[model samples]
Target: MILQLIQVSKSFGDHQVLDDIDFELKEPQIIGLVAPNGYGKTTLFNIISNLEKPDHGEIMIFSEKNTNEKIFEHLAYLQDNRVLYDNLTAREHLAFVAACHNVEQQEIIEICDRLGMSHYLDKRVKKYSLGMKQHLLLAIALISQPQLLLLDEPLNGLDPSSVKLFREIMTELFNKGVSIIISSHNLYEIEKLTSNILFLHDQKLIRNTEIDVPVDYFYFLSDIRKIETELTKNGFFWQSKNSVEFLFTLNECQKEKLEEICQSNDVLIYDCIQKISKTEAAYFSLFT
Candidate 1:
């Protein structure tokens, strides 16, 4: 494994952000961290980067304990534009990172070209747009060629073209055996990147698998009140009921059972829709 966390916990006085979270990742893999704002996604990244000491437990990178100095050598974390010096041009920023990592200048230029950042790399960061800044941040992370890459909201303000470019670069890096962990609010983009997802909820880590498969069946019943008890008794939770009808999320097995229940209860089926991706439904299922 490239990264592992064992019983990690962190708290800030009244708020217990992370609670005994255990996670592991292998090399050359891309994992998505999905959560809402203030859900300790950033806190987890900080702990991995050794910016904040965990209240309890341990973090291991490449089987070595993650430390402050060692992380700078083997890890590259792209947090936000605040890390950028507004007065420095993109080239200057890249050069500074390259110097710290002992990367050659020509290699930095090549990375810029590959990421399509050569157009505005010479302009000061203050004058660059959000997309341009995102490009710079990604380029800086790539310059070090880090064995473990941690990206927090990397695609936040990128345009369509830049988003496509970022995905391409991420794929290239993954192909080269760079283990990456990305935290993003973009569910669709996350689905496109990887199926392995770690969801943080109620100060705990929930590993959600099979996120790549689209839900095969979604059923809406015309008379939900007639079979509400039977549905819940069978361990199937129906969605909202504000509409005249009710929607129930189900899988292939549940669909078969639902058909039998509907037949017995005489519940009229209004619609059956096939979904393209289950990421959204899976996300909301955590809350509901």
Candidate 2:
């Protein structure tokens, strides 16, 4: 098994962040840790990385109990850019991590090149942009060649091209048998990366094997009541944004049926926008 948590709970003062939670990962696969801000996603990652001790629970990684610092050599946690030193160049930062992991200089250079960081590697991190900093952090995490990787909001501030590159690297790592738990608010990108999700809701962990596949359509309609009635009669799941706006999930056949219903009833759909992806649909269903 890659990871296991038993009856883990955490709180600060009167605010209970994480309730008793149990989770397990049996194999190498990307799992998205999803939750609202300040809901213990980072806290869970911290506990797993041994940066913070759990209030009550046992955590196991790679079939052994989490205790020895040496066990973490096979694990990597990519935290926020605050961990980076502004005075040091990207090369200096990477060199520090490489030295700790006993990584060779040639390998460090190759990793920097692979991440497209060789161009500005020698520049001090104080001059780096948010995207550049994210790339540097990822390179630092990858330098250790960890079997298990924990990424906390790694996609933040990345451009489209950079995001694509990150996805490609994650795929490459996953194929190499590396287990990853990445926390990101970008539901669309999360869906693209993995179907498995570990959602934190109500201070507990909810595991989902697959994200919902249905597509959601947001419709601005002229006759809200009529459309609502039709939607209910047609067994379509929907939510009202307002009196005139409604969101519905429909398959191709159901979409055609909806169109026919609107045509027959003269219920004008002023504007229809397809907006939600699988992960987004799941997120809304869970949180909203």
Candidate 3:
């Protein structure tokens, strides 16, 4: 196993963050850590990285208790850009991480090139834009060639092209047997990356797999009661958003039945939108 957590719990005085969280990662696959802001996603990452201790639990990395610093050699964490030094250039920062990992200078250059940082690698971090800084942070994370990578909001401030590049690199690393856990608010991108999801809700962890199920449809209708009655009578799963809005999960035949009901009853659907992927559907079902 790559990582295991047993009865992990944490709190800040009266506010409990995580409660009895148990998880195990046994293979090299990309998993998305999902939760709203201030929900202890970062706290869990910190505990796994050994930056913070769980109030009540045991953590093991690489089949060993996370007590020795040498075990960290196979792990890398890509946190925020605050770890960067404004006075130094990107090359300098990469060199520091390379030296720590015994990586060669040539490999640093190759990584910079791969991440499109060779253009401004010599420029000071103080003058870098948010996207540029994000690229630099990614470079620092890749410098060590770790077996396990923990990325907290790595997609922040990245443009579309940069995001594409980041996804490509992550896929390459996963193909090489590197386990990755990434947290992002972009549910669409998360769906594209992986189907294995770890959700933090109600101070506990919920694991979901094979999330690419049927699409969910959200409809704003003129007659909510009629639609609700029809859906319930037909044995379709649905949730009422409000007086006018309703969300439904329907199969092909169920969808045709819904269309027939609307047409027969003259229920005008003012607006209709589909939750393109199950990831967004799951997010809304869990949190909203």
In candidate 1 the C-alpha lDDT for residue 76 amounts to: 90
Total clashing pairs in model 1: 0
Cα-based lDDT for every prediction? 0.83, 0.87, 0.86
**Rank by TM-score, descending?**
3, 1, 2
State how far residue 108 of model 1 sits from its true place (Å): 0.8
TM-score of each: 0.80, 0.79, 0.81
Give the number of the best model, judged by lDDT. 2
- Candidate 2 — worst ten consecutive residues by lDDT sum? 206-215
Task: Give the winner by TM-score: 2 or 3.
Answer: 3
Q: Across residues 153-228, which tens digit of lDDT does each residue of candidate 1 receive? A: 9998899888888888888888988888999867789888898788888888776764332254556677777877
For candidate 1, the 10 contiguous residues with the lowest summed lDDT are 209-218
Residue runs of model 3 more than 4 Å from their true location after superposition = 210-248, 251-275
Q: What TM-score quantifies how close candidate 3 is to the native fold?
A: 0.81
RMSD of each: 5.4, 5.9, 6.0
